[model samples]
Target: MPEITYRDAVIRGIAQEMARDNDVVFLGEDVAKAGGVFKATVGLYEQFGPLRVRDTPISEQAILGAAMGAAMTGLKPIAEIMFSDFFAVCFDYIANEFPKSRYMSNGQTKCPLVVRTGNGAGSRFGAQHSQSVENWCMMIPGLKVVAPSSPVDVIGLLAAAVRDPDPVIFLEHKSLYATKGEVPDGEIVDRLGTAKIVRPGRDATILALALMVPRAVEAAERLKAEHGIDCEVIDVRSLVPLDTQTILASVAKTHRLFTVEENPRLCGWGAEIVSIVADEAFYDLDGPPVRITTPHIPLPAADILEDMVLPTAERIVETVRRSLQS
Candidate 1:
């Protein structure tokens, strides 16, 4: 294992998958010559050349439509949306058509559309560029959504997303791109739709998705060291095929649940996680499941305001303590 930046891990995943299968291709605006907005696909253009690694026009509708058409015909395309918030532009292709083709065709169609997008509201990108909309994908039918917490997880999950035969929304956080972690040099493909217990505890369970996972983990540590609270941190890696069993089992032990997410609290993914506990393991819970999320408002472009809008480790710790007390 070697320590690598999150950006490197993503490029490695795409490169490995492309080398293994001839059908795997990367396409997006500025993905070829510019090497992606975040440089996730840097050096790939030189290695794979223009045919496999293509730069599409600056239209989300066109990029998604073209990718769906390519996937249906024969090629496996990994289309990149520079920002996750821009998904609104291609809702027709992403939310409606691409996901429904296989279902409508009744097993006749194989929808292997992989849309890799960067999400999150940090680094002052503001409301336009920095929105965590995983909940939208979770609500859609026939879609598999994946969000990795670390460089290692991204390597495995990205590889898994690229290899999956269904329509996979591979999501990465804007903040995690520069974060470094250890990753295996050998093949390590994570199982999509499966959640991982990132940190173990017994006092309470903190379910964090995407960018919140690391913050929750840090909070769990602080809670244990400072307040003598052993909080279990679970990263809900796969949003669509959520690991309900894993979550239920953890709740069975901890008896308290706290969900942390970057999306607005109103009808967000955190509510769904809390709803699941209320439905399945209500009797086992010592307190009501609490959701820690951004207020129902858009993130400000100013760095100071953005810091206040997003959930933090301190916020997670405070929320878990309050829930445990109740």
Candidate 2:
């Protein structure tokens, strides 16, 4: 019933889980005393104390390496990567170690590790800081990838991620950190592998993720108000165990599909969503599937360059309008 920021919702989720379980611990650069770079973990250090909420060195490999070890042994560790782009620094450890532990150990070991990272562009954080690479984690076999668009989702998905018995890439989009939404009262943990229909319509279906979810809904409203093109907007919260059923069901009703994301056009998450729709619900679509995404280039720091490269509501409206006409 009360509106809260996405950042606060995340902190609540972590704190609730940590209070509920002693095995839960948090460690990352600036996560304790500094309270996280984005302030997502503020006030946690004092409440949980230094042992549970720790600040680690700025080494992704070392941080994740320690988290993997802790998770496998007895604890559920939440390791923050600061920026999603830094995951590359520890990809070898993730690829060769964390994800493979369960199978390699023949189910003798479980990796209940959750890596929280700030994701997406639109903050003008430049090429190095701005990237929507959740798709990379989705490609991995043993990892679960989930991105939250609203405050409710941040709390629900993060809570679920903390309790899951495997590695989870929990993405918090930088653009949506300040975004506010009404979160339900009490403990609510939305299951992984589920999608939500943010807006219902009849003309077309717009499938979006993370930061693009709000943009898609905005585009849908504009399309309806100005152009009379109603649209169904879907928030694909969980990427790894994608909710293909929800996507197909929406496509069946609207008869058109469009995928939106901040990631690059080539091989991005949007591409994967559209491909699945095309492959599974081929006959249900009235037009060819469309993908609205950023250009296949580094995100620029300049506002104008970023705007031109990024997907906008105007672009989404136009894309959906053109799809209907064709």
Candidate 3:
């Protein structure tokens, strides 16, 4: 097994898919010669060449539009929207075009494309650049949403997304780019709509995704050590075809549930999960499900304010402890 940073895994994932499939192509701003704004795509340009790996102009609309065209025309294209928030600019493609293409055409057409973006806070990029907008894509009926939390997942899920026969939103957390993890050698491909129980416990279950995953795990460890409140921490790797079975089973065993989300409290993905639990697994819960989330407001630029606004491990510990005690 080799340990690698999440950033390098991005490069390897794209390279692996592009190498295996000639139909796979990548395009985005600064992704070619500059290796991306975050330097995550270094060596791709030289390896794949200009035709396969390209740099696009500064327009999210043009980026996704071209990607949709390429996908519909039998090319598997991976398009990058520099920031996930910019999806608002190309809502038509995401909301109407790419997703509905195959269905609208009565399965006569297929749009197999991937929209990857830098998502989530922790870079102090302020409100516009720091949103965890997986919730936005998850709401659409035809889209498959994926937010990978580790280096291995970044590779495995990216491979899976590239090969799928439909549109996929692959969210890469900006804050997690530097984190390192162990990845087994070989061609790694993972299934979509699966939740991983990173730390298993019997008292409660804490659901989180992307950057919130590590925070929830830390909080779970602290709670067990200090308060004897063991918690099962589940990394919700995929949100669209959500693994509700895993979530419900965890809640059934633990009899308690809590969600830690980086998205704002209003309409966050956790709200949907809580609703599902309440509707289907309400009797299994010993207490009301709790949601620990960022306040419903635009993110602040100041480091102190950003720290206070995002859901922290300390906040998770405090919230879980207080809720259980009450």
Candidate 4:
């Protein structure tokens, strides 16, 4: 086992899959020669060559349309949308085309393609590029949405997404690209619809996704050290096929729930989790489930304002402490 950065893990995951299957192809703007805007796909161009790992035109719609066509014709294409925000330009292909092909054709067609996008805040990319839009894709039916918090999960879940029989939106958090984690040697693949209990405790359950996962874990640590409020932290790695069983079990054990999310307050992924907990595990809860989220506003371009808007470890700790006390 060795420690690897999240950025490198993306390359390894794509390479591993492309090597295993000849049908696997990659195409995106600046992905071939420039090695992607974030350099996450570095060395892929040389490793996979120009034909398989190609650079596409600037049109997001064209990229996805081509990928969808390729997937329909029996090629497993991994198309990068550069920034997740660009999904707005190709919403038709995402919401209507790829996801619906299998259902409409009654199993006559399948779109086993993966849409890889750089997502989340912390690079000061401003409102347009920094929005955490995983919630957008999760709301749509017939799509699998995944956001990995660690290097190991990046490679493992990515492998799973590539092999899946349906469409998958693979969101790579911009902030976590530099973070390092230990990954096992040799083939790494993880199951979709699985939630990881990163930190276990008995007093409260803290659910977080993508960038919020680390913050929630840090908050749990501080809550224990400072206020004696032990909190369990769960990393919601996948959103569409959400692991409700894991979440409900944690809520039952802790008897309290809190969600730390980078998405805006309105219709954030945490809200859905809160609704589920209230609906199914209402009796198991000792207190109302609280959601700590970014205010409903466009993300700021300035570093200070951005930091203020996104949920932090301090905010998580304070929110959990206050909610538990009340």
Stronger candidate by lDDT (2 vs 4): 4
TM-score of each: 0.98, 0.98, 0.99, 0.99
Can you rank all candidates by lDDT, best first? Answer: 3, 4, 2, 1
What does candidate 2's lDDT look like per residue over 1-326, in tens digits?
89999999989999989988999999999999988989999999999998999998888999999999999889999999999999889998667787887898898888998999999998998999999988778878899999999999998899899999989999999989899999988887889999999999999989999889999999999999998999999999999788999989999999988989888878888788888887888999878888888988989999889989889999999888877876
Candidate 3 has an lDDT of: 0.94
Off by over 4 Å in 2: none
On lDDT, the stronger of 1 and 4 is: 4
Query: Between the candidate structures 1 and 3, which one is better when assessed by TM-score?
Result: 3
lDDT (Cα atoms) of all candidates against the true structure:
0.89, 0.91, 0.94, 0.94
Q: Candidate 3, after superposition: displacement of residue 13 in Å?
A: 0.6
Q: Over the stretch 201-262, how does candidate 1's per-residue lDDT look in tens digits? A: 99998999878988999999999998899988999999888899999999999999898989
RMSD of 3: 0.7
Better of 1 and 4 by TM-score: 4
Tens digits of per-residue lDDT for model 4, 139-198: 888999999999999999999999998899999999999999999999999999999999
lDDT of 1 at 51: 94
Clashes of each: 0, 0, 0, 0
Model 3 C-alpha lDDT per residue in residues 264-297, reported as the tens digit of each score: 9988999999999999999999999999999999
* Cα RMSD of predicted structure 4: 0.8
